[model samples]
Target: MNKPPQNSAEMPDYLKARRLHLNGIITLMGDMKKLNARANKNAKVERLTIDAIAAELDLIDLQLKRKCG
Candidate 1:
């Protein structure tokens, strides 16, 4: 039988996952800012897109808090 891999004390699995999640959120926020900059062209559509992204970020925040805390 093969032994399962182990996580080191320096960096646990959850922490690693949290880091990835934070990075993704950072990217999403950056994209949202970019969209906001050009939002004047299509205010209605871009507003919806920004709202969706904000909702997603909120969900991710809740998940990270539950999982990481």
Candidate 2:
């Protein structure tokens, strides 16, 4: 990753950024999932990008869930 992930919530802010990140990731994953479901499942480039995003999202979700971090 070119940029380090930013965390804005500290003390008074408290998990605000993490929660928002989690939510946004979830929304994106859901949209990707819908696309995956509707997709032809045969295109190489399309499948590759979708798979990559899904894999990355899974990692982020696991980290947020305290299963990987």
Candidate 3:
């Protein structure tokens, strides 16, 4: 597992940017999810993307939790 910065101040620029990008993706995914639900479409691609992003966020959260706790 990749180690996170010990603190917010210690985080690198790239990681910060990455987190922001991923957060934006999450927002867009939310819209896509809502649209898919309304249209009753089988959004396999969207589902896969959501799963991948969730997995990545979970990993990052686990690392951050370890650093903080």
- Best candidate, TM-score: 3
- Looking at model 1, the pairs that clash are none
Winner on lDDT between 1 and 3 is 3
Candidate 2 residue pairs that clash: none
Worst 10 residues of 1 by lDDT: 1-10
TM-score of each: 0.45, 0.41, 0.58
40, model 1: CA deviation in Å?
A: 3.7
The residue-by-residue lDDT of candidate 3 on 1-69, one tens digit each, is 366556666664435556667889989988877867776566777778888987887776665566456
Report how far off residue 58 is in candidate 2 (Å).
Answer: 0.3
Clashes within 3 Å, all models in order: 0, 0, 0
- Candidate 3's TM-score reads 0.58
Q: Ten residues in a row with the worst lDDT in model 3?
A: 9-18
RMSD per model, one decimal: 7.6, 6.4, 5.0
Q: Which sequence of candidate numbers ranks them by TM-score, best first?
A: 3, 1, 2
Candidate 1 lDDT over 1-69, as tens digits, reads: 333235444334544555466567668766776777855667676557657756765665675566557
